[model samples]
Target: MKSACATKYEQIEEPDMANIVDAVLEHEADDRPAIVGETRTTSYRDLVDLARRLTGGLRQRFRNDEDVCLVVSHPGLEESLALTLAGWSLGHRVAVLPPYLKSRELEYALEQCSPVVTVSDQTPDSAGSVAFRTLLDAPASDLGSSASEAWLETFTSGTTGHSKCVDRRVSRLSDDIEQLASAMGLSADDKVTAMTTALSTTSVLPALLAGSTVVTIPLQTARQFWKAISDTSITVISGTPYAYEFAGRKKPEPGQLKNVRMALTTSARLRPDTARRFMEDTGVSIRNIMCSSESGHIAYNSSTDEELLAASVGKTLPGVTVEVRDDAGKVLPVGQSGRICIKSPYTATGYRNDPDSSAAVFQGDWVVSTDVGYLDAQGFLYLTGRDDHKIHFGAAKLDPQELEDILLSHPAVDDVLVVGEAHVRLGQIPVAQVVTSRETEAAELLAYCREQISATKVPQRIEFVDKITKDFKGQPVRPKYVRFD
Candidate 1:
């Protein structure tokens, strides 16, 4: 199941579509380190050469037009980036296995992607996975195509309760780079570090494609993440709502990250209080970016309008069109929440081998991945929750993210996941699975929730523990409450 080779740019009418990697390589003003790690600093030239070597290595085991599973566990960030781009250089689709993927999940992904070769740290027990050293044996050549012709296959959580592989071309990825770069004004001059799960489109690829240096800490030791930023004079930091909350409360020593200027939060709800607190403590501004892996960024807060600053996900980036539509697919009026549909070259082609799932979301030129939000009169987007995540409490409906955001605002709460539990009297009730800091007590937290949101939105049960479970990519998985199955 290999993807096709390069197609001419004219074949696709994608706006802002161009070879971003070529642009970065040719136009970058700094020859100094574009990627820095604990032991080494990688310059633009080093990245290019390393990618060339890796491409040559991959060519030995697989043809120019094959897909490969990159089971990267390199200690250095520069090495990881080199391997990824090298696969693209050779026209191979790179499917990254999560750093902490269990044996069974890893096995399933390998079978699905059907990589001809596996580029891994240590050869897995699998008979045919290729070794990293093997890829190094071949010689580098000027690969024929630009990055726009290459692609990566990211696995998304499916409606069938399993993971589905989503095919995304480099052109699609460049669309994201454009938005983040335009909205945040990211430049080569900025040194960014993201403390999110690495096997994500936002955390790794977009930062690299933007030509900004990004630092990644493995998911296994996420607690030690601040050290990565503290050591480097990171200019930009991106993470989930949980990450921002944790960092804001902890307020890591200013000396460790004195140079940081921006903190961007995505993939979860953003709290105005949390944003203000983080900025005050760290001397950095918090920016909210609204997007999904299925659909690229539709809007981002421009940091101007206070109300938009308080609730909305900002404005649409350049060359991106966002529409709020009814189930009938009619465009809705401003300030009315509906299905969010986005048209961008950055959105995915479709979920691979899952036409039904693809058809559920892909509508003509736009793809709607169940985000229920609306644009205000000023065009700022306010996201409620995914349509799939909506739950009924008594006769009232609630979005889990709304409850989750409120729970996270508590000073003693470190992390929280709000899930709907089936009830005999009510259809479903919200339950909070909380990971707390030192001071938060379950009963006190319940009182706080009652004070903040409506009683219907309050958690019917508060389960306090040391940790909240997350997927291999570090996205929070709903903690199931089905006691009897």
Candidate 2:
């Protein structure tokens, strides 16, 4: 399942205020389909006009030129993109939101952005919120006259903790789109399936802007996902490793995804088992692309080389540089794991309104990642775990990723999460919440772990679960594994 590696790099040009709106302007008169949704289809021509109308609607309704929050609740809907581009056309910073947020989570995001306007299929929590349909039906007006650059705000996956906003400008987004597509070797004719990330800068933008047809489908099961690929003749796919596991389990028909030439997995680590199994079933090796909300994409792994994909996300994508530095800002020598920092042409300005947090992560053109990994001799980035989520067992802090990788080797173990819980004597003790496909006991897993890792790193308690649920970003919800204590 080895694929083509990134062989070219290019300088990112700062596009004018077109943001996303300018993407389809070339086909304004041509009726070629640009976005294929589950419920509707938007031709390149209609996409432009609809977004223009929405732009007029935004101006007529809420004239604030700052930020607008778009709740992308409906899957495969054209209006979400239309409204985003619509907002950008007016020099408005558009913050795209996931639909799965609880009331409290949604409130936090809304409060931070304080968007002048909000649009969603559901009633948004913001003050000036309006129905998506209303915005879509508004009379078309000329694109906004403001020359201010539009911004894009995305949230961190928050798999191990809370989510934060990553505010980047549209000019940066344009360059990011080019680098990501080049890394994946995506082309204008490459039909792409965006099950969850139809609006994300990484997936849809590359194809949509390049005039490649983008297919959006409801992410219910692999059956439906594969069907969309077959129906639309999808040639490229981007999603999380969590979703790809299902596609492999369902097993596609022989040559069903023959049109799908490549795929990219992000958000969380792509387990070797998941990647190889999918490759075996579908002949499509999953390349684990390292991406961040603050920075669009940093690395690309095109090959399924066992040692490479298992340890490293990949080498740096085109026009991207990954540097490893120590706590005092000294560049660590190669192979020495430390802070994973990325430098590229396009990057988030910072986390919105959180100056302290923003200062820590967004340092000039570099996005200082909390991830801990090192570059191999050949320049591949190997991400071990987050710097913050170490399991502290009486001052002997352990990376959960290392421990989980050991538990994953078990025959019956399907998935595992290791976390530290407060204990009177140990200060904190390791607890393992494991997902299994067949019969297994905590005692058996404990014994298996003892054989692989040291006892201090082993889970003191093991809890069995049916499955590990993921958030909207397809990140596993790494809650404290709450105990009644």
Candidate 3:
């Protein structure tokens, strides 16, 4: 049986709820590239047709508007995109969970949300979970109800704590899409790359809606990531700071990334060295996007101003507001550092099934962020670090990024994490775990820090390590794996 959405497979102008279906149908007749995978390219016509075919399978099992479809994949670009298109087309709440979630963690998510159906590459150890191929070949039926408004539930990175499930309206997701598409100056000719699952939301979805071709590859390592990009005519790349730094570390041959014109990094602070190295090698400056899973795209360093590029995350996106507020919730003036609160039309409403946590962060219109930063006179945001990321020495608080920046400036320091460990007398002291390029000593680095920053913020203990632990996104896993007895 052909689903109602499939009936409009070739012609859906103004679709219901304005989700990915509309994007798919917008170029249903055009065969131009939609997704550029490692081995294959899926055109808009092909992607939409596949999505429409899958809609029939989805329509058979669940009641539209009432049931939820949980998509669990290693997050292959096409499979998740197809399932998401089908789910959103049918008005089901589609929650896309992270691929890295452990089995028990996935079970916890399943219990919390209780989706009526789960789609994944492998049939998860759950009752209603189905494999991608199974759903693709399942017989179509007309048991589905009429489509209604659909919402998407995506997760926060939870870098500092447990990941919260953010239930966001489709229209709001579209809001950021349009704004970001415009901000990036994306055109039909541009080819963007989705480096990781985290990028599918921020990069993949937006690129499709803007009608830009999206490139996908398995980012196993920095070398693998480079090999994938070397041949593709990828113009736009928006990924984690880890991706850029990791790629820049090997230092590609001159003009290796010549085709790339624009580079964007997520909320993770782009190391100045990494940015400078990428620019020198590729001739494209990496712009830092100050954003979170909770607030969507808040501010982007979209300017060419040297000071702005060096110090801030640029200015707020259109229709977005940023304020620096003190601990007591009073708004701080320009140049004063405090909590960075974001008020946006497209931010997630609240955490699903977690009211207390939602109430703490999602205060009415503005979502209070743990990030601490200040705005310049021109409204550019300069970040110090997260509130929890701060290391306390006696009563004095230490900004890890600030100290890391000072350490990184020294030629000897390669990559470093400034974590807090307890001292016998002092409650918490800053400890610098350094990864060096050349031979360096704790005393030499100590002298460098003493010259750059305040004596109190300098690392009390500097440990020479081969490597520091990093998250999947290439960000340092904080607290430094230091075991304190």
- In candidate 3, stretches whose alpha carbon ends up further than 4 angstroms from where it belongs are 1-19, 98-100, 124-127, 138-148, 158-161, 197-199, 220-224, 389-485
The full ranking of all candidates by lDDT, starting with the best, is: 3, 2, 1
Instruction: Flag regions of model 2 displaced more than 4 Å.
Output: 1-19, 64-76, 122-127, 144-147, 158-161, 303-311, 390-485
For candidate 2, report its TM-score.
0.73
Clashing pairs in 3: none
**Tens digits of lDDT, candidate 3, 1-485:** 11122222224232233344576577878989888876788899877777776787776666654556455554566767767777766777777654655553466556555554677776753567766776667654322221445667765533111345666656667767767777888878888888754435567887888888998755577677766676787788877665775676576665557778888877456556666777777677888877777788898788886446756678998778998999899999988888899877777767777777777887767789888888988888888756666564543446677678778888888999988886532446888999999997899999887766546567998999999898999988885222212
Worst 10 residues of 2 by lDDT: 1-10
Return the TM-score for each candidate structure: 0.72, 0.73, 0.73
Error (Å) of candidate 2 at residue 31 is 2.2
lDDT of 1 by residue, 1-485 (tens): 21221132225576654355564455334566666655567777777777777777766666654445554545445666677777666666776654444453456566555553555667653546766766676887454334545777766541111456667776667667665676687776777765533544554555555677766543233335666677676778877665665555466664766777777777666666766676666666677888765676767777754455657778888768899899899999998878888877667667666667676766666777567777878777877655666555543446677667777888888898888886543546778888887866688989987776555457889988788888999988864322211
Best by lDDT: 3
lDDT of candidate 2 over 319-386, digit per residue (tens): 68889999898999988978889877666777766777877776766778877788878888887656
lDDT, candidate 2, equals: 0.68
lDDT (C-alpha) at residue 316 in model 1:
84
List lDDT for all candidates, in order.
0.64, 0.68, 0.70
On TM-score, the stronger of 1 and 2 is 2
